[model samples]
Target: MHLLIITREWPGYVLGGISHHICNLYNEVVDKGHEITVITGTCPQSSHELTGKKPPANEVHTVQFGYRKGYYVLFPIALRNYLQSFDFDPFDACITHTGVPFELPLPTVSKRHDCYEATKEYIRNGLSFLETIGDRLMGPFRTIVDRRSIAAADCLIYNSAVCRAGWESAYNITTPSIVSHNGIDTSVFYPDSGYNKEDYILFVGGSERKGLSHVISFARQTKEDVIIVGPDEVNSPHVDALGRLSSDELRQVYTNAAVTIHPAGWEAFGNVILESVACGTPVVATKNCGAVEVLPSSACVVTSEIERGVMKAKNLNSEDCIKAASKQTWDKPAQDMIDIVRSITNPEC
Candidate 1:
């Protein structure tokens, strides 16, 4: 099957887990012998520099969409024009990884990695006064777009049950959806046998909703060093901000850290937790997030008990971490996607 994937974040332009998710799925689908084309947004980083790895799309067409707040409103319009101008045979299926395209000739499947409603809830609960006001002004428009996009799709795919529930609750509609968890690349993120682990704690995410403030507070109370890797630069006496690291470098950090922390109030799916476990590192994650779905109860703890969680994680066996991570890989989810697309094209099959 020839597949066309539309996403704002691709390899080299990775904004978060969604980028990695798309890239990994692209690689797996291609390896299975399907021709793939990607319509993605522009990013400043070159393909090679994105992750010290080349992008996997067989054909990539970039659009000039910026990553600012209101740019998504124009994405479907720009994408519609681009597709109209392109001359090609019909694609078997078009998968919108983030949101639905304004128009598409092929069977369209919308994949929801994050729900706008959940994001809005987070903003309302966590943002400053100014930010909250800004969200209020844009809320209606965003809601309209989000509803139309989801309703437009022939089928829906969600990264987690939390994401699906949030969308359904927000829109007051229950569309049939596939709940497929994101996977990790074991080859790149697996345990490093030679390097000795460190005593420092690690946190990877740029947003305040990712529980950065909570992690900082925990770091201040503990004597252990805290290393942060993300787009945001955090300034705290107890925290050392590395900004962002390549996949290889991040793998090393995960492998060496005593424990990784994910304090996010909510996540569609927490790739960081899986990545840390895949690297033979235990994680201390908050309850009520998507990580709870994949992580064992032993590894998950309430946010208030993060310090104690860290102590428990320290004694977790490295092998146990790897074993838990091994259950999730790109193969299953990629194949599941392929089957969904095929079923859409040939319902009798």
Candidate 2:
């Protein structure tokens, strides 16, 4: 099958988990002998240097766009016009991630990586008064775009059941959908015996929604070292800010940590938890996040008692940690996606 994938993020220029997810899926699908054409925003040179890997799409069309507020309004318009100008053979099916361009053909599947309403709520709760006001001013436009994108799709794919349910309840959406949890590359994230284990707690993610403040507060309470890795750095004495390590370095950090904590109040799916567990490191994650769907009870804990949760997780068997992560890989989800496309293109089969 020839697939046309439209997304704002891609590997070697990853903005978040969605970037990694799409890249992994692209590789898996291509391995199955399907041709993929990707239309995405220009990837920063720095990101390519950091990841040290080439972009995965068979054909890539990069558009120049800024990270400013109005880019959201402009990008879709530009994308739609660009797609309309294509003079080549028609694609078998279209698969979009996150944002969708307007008026795309049917059999196009829109994969919702996160719940927009839930994210807006997080911004409202986590931002300053001035920032909240700015967000409020932009709320209506964002809502319209989000609704139109979701409404335009022939089928919806969600990264987690929690994300799907929250979106349905918030938007009153009755669209047909499926939940296909995101997966990790076990080969890259697996535990390494050579890296000696450390005594620090690891927290990944730089955003306010990622529970950065919660991590700092937890760090202050604990006597052990706390390492925080992300785009931004914090100045707290309890925190060692390592801004964006490469995947190889991150895997080592995960393998050596005493415990990794994910305090995000909500996540479409927590890839960090899977990465941590795959490295044979136990994790203490918020009970409400998507990680809970795949994690065993022994690894989950409430946000309020993160310290206690860490202690409990430390006692969890390493084999169990790897076993749980092993169940989720790109292969199954990629196959499921192919099935969905087939059902649409060849209904009788």
Candidate 3:
């Protein structure tokens, strides 16, 4: 089967959880004897100096669409024009991995990494009303576009039940959907990485929506040794800032730390939670994070009370955490996606 994948985040081109998800999914789908044609935007990693390792060789054919101007909302219009201008081969199915909605002539699946409704809510809480005035003004336009584009797709794939709930809650409608969680590269993020355990809290992401403020409060309250990578500088005595670490360095921290904290305000699926667990470190996450849904009861303490959760997670069984994380490789979700595509294109098995 020939599949069409449309996304902005491509391997080596963009850095994020979505990029990692799409890159691994593309590889997994290709390995199962399917040809993939990708349409992506230009977001180069070189601009940010993510130069530790070369991106894995992507075997699929890819085409990039250069938008004349900005606005992520313009992707649909640009993609429509790009397809109309070129003569492309018919694909059995098209999977769109984008925040905004997209439409395709072929059988299409909307793969949602995050939902905007809850995202906006979290953003508003983090910022002032004036800061969100622009979003408020553009809300109707975005909602209209989403209604037209996403409602027309044959199927929708959500990264987590939490994400799906948020999407549906905002729209007050339902669609043909499947909850296929993100996968982890167990080979790199595993227990026994030759790192001695240390008594400290670790917070990975540095975004406002990721609850950076919550982590800061936790650090100040507990006065525990906290190694983080978010803020440009650190003034606190308890917190040590490691600007940005390579994949190897990140894994080393995950293994050595007593616990990893993910106090996300509205995460679709917190990959860092699983990554920390895969490396034999327990996690402390809020219910707003989707990754907490699949974690074993023994692996993490799900609570916004970071101080208590972080302290309790330190005693969580490492073997239980690793056992749960080992099952989340990319191939399983890719195969499930293939099944959905085949079902859409060919009604009879």
TM per candidate comes to 0.88, 0.90, 0.89
Candidate 2 similarity to native, TM-score: 0.90
Which rank order by TM-score, best down to worst? Answer: 2, 3, 1
- Steric clash pairs (candidate 3): none
Q: How far is candidate 3 from the true structure (C-alpha RMSD, Å)?
A: 3.0
Residues 1-349, candidate 1: write the lDDT tens digits.
8888888767766654566677788788888999888887654432433454535666788876644455456566667767778754757888887665354677888888887677666657667898789878887877777877877788888888887887887886554578888888899898776878999999999776678788989988998899999855677878999978877899999999999989887777888888998998888887646755876755444454778988888888888888888888889888889988998889999
Please identify model 1 stretches exceeding 4 Å from their true place: 12-16, 43-58, 101-103, 121-134, 231-233, 298-304
lDDT tens digits by residue: candidate 2, 1-349: 9888877766655555566777678789888888888877643431443254433566778665556344455567667767677744658888888566375764788888887688777667767899889888877887788788878887888888888877887786766789888888898999886777788899999876777788889899989799998955696888999898878899999999988999887777888888998998888887657767877865545455788888887787777888888988888889878988988888899
Q: Once model 3 is optimally superposed onto the true structure by TM-score, how far is the C-alpha of residue 148 displaced, in angstroms?
A: 1.9
Of 2 and 3, the candidate ahead on TM-score is 2
